[model samples]
Target: MILRVLLISLFLFFSLQSSAFSLEPVYSLQDCINIALKKNPEILASKATVNKSFFKIGEARSGYFPQIDLSLGYQRSYLENKIGEEYSKQYSAQMSLSQTLFDFGKTSKQVEIQQQFYKATEWQDRDTVLQTIYSVKESYYSMLKAKKQKETAQEVLKQAQRHLDLAKGFYEVGLKPKIEVTKAEVELSNAKLNLITAEKQLSQALLNLKVAMGAVDMPDFDIKDEDYAVRKLNENEAIQIAIERNPQLQAIKFNKQASISTKELVKKEYFPTFTGSASYGYLNEDFPLDKRWTVFFQMSLPLFSGWSTTYRLKQAESDIVYYSSKEDSLRQQITSQIKNLFVQLKEASQKIETLKIALKQAKENLDLAMGRYEVGIGSSIEVVDAIVLFEQTNTQYWQAIYDYNVTYAQIQKTVGWVE
Candidate 1:
């Protein structure tokens, strides 16, 4: 009975674990970002890289530890000569340790270099996370825009159908021209075309969102669209945050520091190298072997390597300087982008409000124009103008919302989150 219970428990455990891995995220933006942070291929690779660096650190430090050896041997000799036959068995054990006496601090410096590289790998992980957040937010906003556009297309189609009905009523009574009916038919056709286009765009956006979430199959999902206007930010504060928290600039700065440390390490090559070793083994002169223990210290001098060390040092130094310059340039570029986006965010906020008002007014005008055209009091031209204006306003509103969301995500990504 216990064995049966254990088997059932195991089966349940495996089933639950499988469900956990088969991600079907009907996720919010926050959930998508969190999943991406955990599952992004680049971030996972960076984690592995950091782990490898840790192992390398241990490998480097192991050089400062001791080593031991043991041996056992047996020999038998048989000769049909003047000499006789002999047999012997021997056993030996030894432990030998060597610490870094001095390699001009080479061992310590190597460890330091590895430590810096690991740190940079940590920074690389952060950079990758920031990129992932940006991507998910962009896709999320894009999906929202696509949804709004589809709604707009449906509204336009409804308006076109109403015009068609009015055109038919007037034509049957002999008050509307035949061409007006034809024009209404054409307008309805165009609305259908737009609806089809909007749906296609929405499908593509949904696929992109799912890809961003790193999900194989996701249920129907909706993005948060309410209250999507950009929030106000003081330019000075935004710039300060970006400068303080930007991962790209910080990562390159770490890389430059690591390169400098490596350059210093290379310069140490001019110093002598010292190592110690010991071993225990059996040595035999006759059929029987004798045990012996041995210990020794090794010292090496780097007189010259045809300028190889010099060239290596020079290359390291150059890389340090080059990366430092690149770091500076990258900071400037980010600062410029932050400034531009600050203005853009502010402008987009104002534009959203403006377009909100415009949409309302256009909707009212379209209603009034439709009423007049149905009674033959309004011209076809006015109805057409109203349709265009209404569509334009909706387009502007949705575009502003998309822009606001993307910029908000940008601001957050620029400012590192509190750990």
Candidate 2:
């Protein structure tokens, strides 16, 4: 009895532990968006890039400090003709430091380059955040749509079951034909099959949303939304906003400025550089940096290196031109995308309204056909036609909503608010 009690207690303990850390049965789409932004792999990757950029800035700043080096070595040498050996081994140590007193602004330009690179990485991180948020939103809405579809299918199954029972009652009383009973059975069977399909699809959509939230082993959670529909975009306003506020454009502009810095660095190479170097050494006879103290100062000049420096400067100028072209091309592309998004947004609004009206018409048609069939005045063909039309309208509305959502995501992506 004690062992049994212990086992039960252990099981309860583990169950409670599991429940505490496991995914909750409830989550709002907003919660999912927050979780994805914090944990998504793309955001992690961008964070790493930002760290890398930080190290690069450090590398550029390292030049600001004077370089210092130390050396220690031993050597032995003999003369061709010697009186008691011309050379002898000795201990040595030396230290030298270098400072860039002047380099025609090369150091400053390099620092600027790294700073721009850091900004670019920050923009990339923001882009990743936007992308993760939008992706989660899309998946969240998809799951909501699937859940509703399953609910609708279940309702249809219940309706078909009711109709089937009504048909059997009528047949027993000799009020309905045999064909009507068969038709009702067939419809109930189809409805059951549709419910099964919808349930499977809904289950998969839920899993996808969980994956987006970075909760692969999460428990099942239902999607709840009062309405899933596209909000119309202000066509011209959106275009203007995209033009001014897009991060991609800002990123490209920063890149162009970095290119200009590169050109300035290259132009600086034409001028002379001045650096201060100092070395201190301790040396012995025929040895390097040994016992006796020594000190030296150095100032070096780059007389010429063929035409390499000139060609390199030209290359830098060419790069500036190249990046300028890419910037303009990207600008044109973003503009076109903004315009296209506006057009699609407008089109989707009209389609949704029209589909809503069509759905109402289809429902009326089904009701009329059912009433006729009940009075022995309607054909099986009419009933089937009504069913088909209603389902078609049902599927059309979901598809339209899906298309609208996808297009809106594309618009956000163009604006660099979505990756």
Candidate 3:
């Protein structure tokens, strides 16, 4: 009795563990977006670029503080004369400090340029995030669509098999022709083929979703069946939100500001600069022998630099104009995108309604035909045709559903909001 009880306990333990491991992981839309944003390599690379730009801010600020340097040197010299020859060794250590007394706001302008550039980089990172989120949504919805298609195919196959069996029964009893059995068998074969194709497509879609989420090697998983509804939204309001919050537009604005600061920085190069320096030194024949200190002040003016500075200033000014034009172009593009997606969303919603009605009619037609055949008043071809019509309408309805959800996701991305 004890041995039997121990075996039972071990079996129960293993069964529980197996059930735990076999549980299907289901991800919602938000879950997929979050995973892509957190783990996608492209998104991470863009983040690294933003960090590198942030470091430039510190580099630009370094010019505002005093600069210091220390150096050590050893020198050996031999002198020969008519009377005698002598050899001497000298060792020197020196420390120097230099401070910018004034530069007409040159360093400040440089710092401002770096700050603006960093802001642009930050916005670029946000844009990358938005793009990744959109991609995840696209893949997620596609996987859902494929799964639905596969389910529909399986249902159609089962119905076709039943019809083939019925046709065989009728022919064997001398109530139907052999051609009816052949037709039903052909239909069943077609349905089976479609189901096989749908299964392959579903597997491919699952792989695509995993790739989009950067979980390429993850175990087989499923997505939650979410019924996405179309929400009423004012088109003008959406455009306004896009203008205000779109990261690509914001990045462009920052780039223009940085260009202006760069022009100022370049123009400042024409003005004179003043610097003050002090140095303390020790010089000895062998060890510590003598100590000395020196101080100096210097001023420099760029009388000419082969016209390079002037060209640089012109280039900076041109960049400011270029970025401004780019901002305008981007605004136009964004507005057009919002309008187009809004129209598509509306169309998809309408299509879904139309397809739903057609699907209802198709089902009714299939039922009527089946009932007529059971009562010996209808032909088998009519029933098969009705079945095909019903399947087509059903597939169309699901396609419309997937299209609406995809368009909604794009609209959200265009407006620069995804949570």
> Model 2: clashing residue pairs?
92-289, 92-290, 93-289, 282-289, 282-290, 283-290, 283-291
1-419, model 3: which lDDT tens digit per residue?
Answer: 99999999999999999999899888888888888888899899999999999999999899889999999999999999998999999999999999999999998898899899999999889888888888888898889989988988987888788788888888999999999999999999999999999999999999998888888988888899987676989999999999988999999999999999898889899899999999999989887658989999999999989999989989999999999999999999999999999889999999999998998999899889877876667888898998899889888998999899889888888889866
Query: Across residues 165-246, which tens digit of lDDT does each residue of candidate 1 receive?
Result: 9998899999999999999999999999999999999989988977877763757565656466446667778677767777
Ordered by lDDT, highest first, the candidates read 3, 1, 2
Q: Which residue runs of candidate 3 sit more than 4 Å off their true CA positions?
A: 1-20, 77-86, 371-376
- Runs of candidate 1 with Cα error greater than 4 angstroms are 1-26, 69-98, 216-220, 285-288, 417-419
Question: TM-score of the candidate numbered 3?
Answer: 0.92
Per-prediction backbone clash count: 0, 7, 0
lDDT of each: 0.80, 0.76, 0.90
**Please, what are the lDDT tens digits per residue for candidate 2 over residues 60-102?**
9888899999998677766756455465566777888878887
The candidate that wins on lDDT is 3
How many residue-pair clashes does candidate 3 contain? 0
Q: In TM-score terms, which candidate is top? A: 3
* Residue 74 miss distance in model 1 (angstroms): 8.3
